[model samples]
Target: MSQANPPGRPLLASALGGLGLLAGMVLIAEGGRRLPPDPPSIAPAQGADHLKAASHAPLHDARPGRSARKVAADLIAPPPLDPSGIERTEPRPPLGELGLAPRPKTPMPRDWRETLLFRPVATSSAVFEAMGRTVAISGTVDIDPDRTCTFDNTDWSCGQRARAAFNAWLRGRALKCFLPPDADRFAIAAPCALGKQDVGAWLVSNGWAMAAPTGIYGKAEMAARNARMGIFGPPQ
Candidate 1:
C-alpha cells in the first residue's frame, strides 16, 4: 500500500526498523563465530566474552603436630669466645706489706677484746669469686710450720686443716667459679698474723676486722687502744 505520510515522517518506518534489527543480530553472530573460543575461563565473561576470576581462594590449614625435627631445629647454639685466649695477670702484692708486716697499713688494728664477730660459714669460694668479680679472700691461710692448731683439745696440723677446708669449700661448683690466683685485686683485707692460736680461734677471741683480700687484725682492740693499723686506714 502507498501509505500517505506526514511531511516530517518517512513512510516505511516500521519496515526499515525491522530490517536494522535483523542486521544487528547477523553482525553479532558473525563476529562471535570469527573470534577464537575463549581461553578456558576460571570466571565469568565480560560484555558476554571476558570473564572474572575468583577473588577468594581456599585457605590451607597449618598442621598441628609435634615432631623430633621441630625440636631439633628449634634449638639455638651458644656463641663462643675463648676467654683463656685472653692473657691475664696476678695481682701485685699490696703496698702495705713493705716487708711482711702481716697486715695492711691501716689506722684500725685488731681488737682482740670482743669488738668483732667471728662466725665462719663455709661455702664455695669459687662461687663467691665468680659472682663478685672483684671479690678476694685472704687470711692466715698460709701460716708457716710450728703454728699449733687445737681441735677438740688435740693438736691438729695448721696446714692440713687449712688445705682441707679450702679445697672442699670450692668443690662441686662450676669450673669457672674459681678465679686464677695473682689477679691484681684490692685487699679490702690482708692475711691475719696470729702469734699463738689458729685463725678461727684468734679471730673469735680477739674480735678482729678484715678487708676482702687483705689482712685480719684485732681492729676493735686497736681502735680502742689507739693502736696503729698503719697507713692505708682501718681494716674494712
Candidate 2:
C-alpha cells in the first residue's frame, strides 16, 4: 500500500509548474520580436518604379551603394583636391627663345624688269658666278684636244693650256651679265680689260677656242687661224 502525499508538497509542485509555463511563454514572445522580419515582400522587378530603383541603387557600402573595395581604396588614397595641382620642374621657354621668332619681311620688286641680286655658289672658267647665278661665256665654245696647230706635230693638250690661260685672265676681274630670253642662258660680254690685258680678245686671238655658231667672235677666230697662233700654231 502507498502512503498519501503531504498537502504542502502538492501546492509547491503546482506553483512551480505555473512559473515554468509563464517563463516559456515570455521567451517565445521575445524570440519572435527579435527574429529578422520576413524578407521584404519582393514586388515583380518588371515594374517601371522597380527598374528605376534598381538603376539608381548604390553598388557599395558605407558610401551608399559604393562597393566595400572602392571605399577601402578611397580611405587608402584620397582623391586629389585639384587636378592641376602638380608642378612642372622644367618650364617651357618663351616662343622667341625657342626659335619660333617671326621672320623679317622682305621688300618685293616693283616690276618684273627690276633685278634682285643673290650670291652664286659655284664658278668655273666658262661660267661666271654672280648673285648665285651662272652666266656662260656667250660666244665661246669649250676648248678640246682636237683643236690643232700647223706649226708643230708634238701631241700637246691645247684644251688644258687654254683653260689655264682663261682662268688666269679671269682672276681679279668682274663682268656685267644679262639674262637672255631663254631661261636657261645668260649673255655677258667681258669688258675690254681683265687684269692687265684685254682677256676676251686675248682668248680668241690666242687660238684657244672657236667662235660660236652665233658668229659673235667670228672675226677674232679668223685672225687667229690665219696667224697660226695659240693652238693654231706649233705646240709649245
Candidate 3:
C-alpha cells in the first residue's frame, strides 16, 4: 500500500526551498560589493650604466698591446669608475723631536702609452724607453765587419747601382714613398770591389741627384736619398 504526504507538511517544505534559493542570491551580491579597486604597479629603478653597456655589443679587451692608443683614448673618455679604489699614500716629513720613518709615496700608474712601452707585462723581456710619440735608436754598427764588403761591380756598380736599382724597385710600388738604404749605413753585397766612386755613380744613374760628394764614405751615405722616397727626410 502507498502512503501520501500530509498536505500541511508538503506546503512547509516548498516554502523552505524558495527561502534557500533567495538567501544564496543575496550572499553572492553582498560578496561582489566588497571587492577592492585594482592596486598600482611599482617600477624598478635602472642605472645609466646598465643601458650603456647593453647598447654596445661585446669587444675584445686589447688593454695590453695597444697601451698608447688605449691611454690616449682613456684620457679623452674617462672610465665610469676607477677600477682600483685604493688611495695614494702621502709622504710624511721627519718628526721634530723623535725622528720617524717617512711614508713612501706610491707611484701612480702611467697612462696607456707609458704602460704599453714601460709596463709591458709580457713574456718577451723587451723594455723600451722613448720620449713623445717616436722611438729613438742610437748605437754604433760593429765597424769590424762593416769596413770591407766584397761585391761584383760591372758597368753598373752592383753595390752602389744596386742601391739605386733598389730605390727604383721600391718606386715601382703604389706606396706613397720608399727609401733605399744609404751605402754607408747599409752596404751592397756584391761579387766585385765597391768604392766611394761606385756608390756615387749608382746614385746618379738611378735618377738620384748627387749632393756635394764628401770624400768621407760616411758623409756620402748620409746624403743618400730617403729610403721611403719622400716619406721621411734623406737617410741619416
Candidate 4:
C-alpha cells in the first residue's frame, strides 16, 4: 500500500474544505443583506375602494374610456324641441314682464261705402251707423200706420208728425252709442240719448207717440191725450 497520506496533511485538507463551505455561506448571507428590499406589490383598488373612487369622481369621468369632449357633450342638456319639430313661440312669458296689456283697437275701413250699413229693424228699432249695432226706443209704442186719429171730423194717420221729426233728427248726427247690461249688440237700450234727449220719452210726452201697452209712459200719453195735442186734437 502506498504510504498513507501524511495524517497531518489529510486532516488539514479536511479542515480547509469545511472552512471554505462556511465562508461561502457567510458571503451569500451578506450579499442578500446588501440587496434593497423588494418594493411592496401594489394591488389594484377593489370593492369598497373602487366604489368610493367612483362616488368621488366627476360625473363625466364615471363612464369608461370616453374622451373629454364626448363626456362634455353627453353631460350637456339637449336643445328643447316640440314633438312636431316645428319652431314656435315660447309658452312661458319672460321673467321680466308678466302681465299683458290690452290689445290695440282694430282700424275701421277708409271708405264710407265700405263702412257698416244700418237699417230700420222695426217701427221703433233701427240698426245704427255701425255694423252689428242697433238702438231701441226703451219705453214707447211704435206709431201704427194703420191706426187713425179723429180731429175735426177728419182722420189723421197716427203720429205722422212724430215719425217725420224723428227721421229728420237722426239724419243730422254722427252716432256713437253704448250697450247696457244684459243688452245685445243690436238691442235698443232705454236710456238711449240723441243729443241729450231721450227720444222715446220726448216723442210720447209731446203727443207724437203712444205709451207702450206695458205702460212705461202711460201717464205722459194720457196727459197729451187729455190736452188734445197732436193726433189727439179734436176734429179740426
Instruction: List TM-scores for all candidates, in order.
Output: 0.19, 0.37, 0.14, 0.38
Query: Which pairs in model 4 have colliding backbones?
Result: 136-188, 151-235, 151-236, 152-235, 152-236
What are the per-residue Cα lDDT tens digits for candidate 1 across 1-236? Answer: 79776865664787799899998899798875674678864444353342223334434555777333433543565557698798878977877745565544544343312111122232322112333333223442233223344434556454334333444543433322122343325322222222333333232223222222333434443452354321112321
Residue-by-residue lDDT tens digits, candidate 3, 193-225: 122224233333332322333322333334343
lDDT of each: 0.37, 0.58, 0.34, 0.58
Q: In candidate 2, what are the lDDT values of residues 9-59, reduced to their tens digit?
A: 989999999999998899798875664569666567656787788899976
List per-candidate RMSD values in Å.
22.1, 22.4, 26.2, 23.3
lDDT of 3 at 157: 24
Give the runs in model 4 whose Cα sits over 4 Å from its true position.
1-132, 174-189, 213-216, 234-236
Model 2 regions more than 4 Å off: 1-125, 128-131, 145-151, 180-200
| Residue 72 CA displacement from its true place in model 3, Å | 77
- Per-residue lDDT, model 1, residue 219, is 43
Comparing 1 and 3 on lDDT, the stronger one:
1
Residue-pair clashes, model 1: 35
Candidate 2: worst 10 consecutive residues by lDDT?
Answer: 113-122
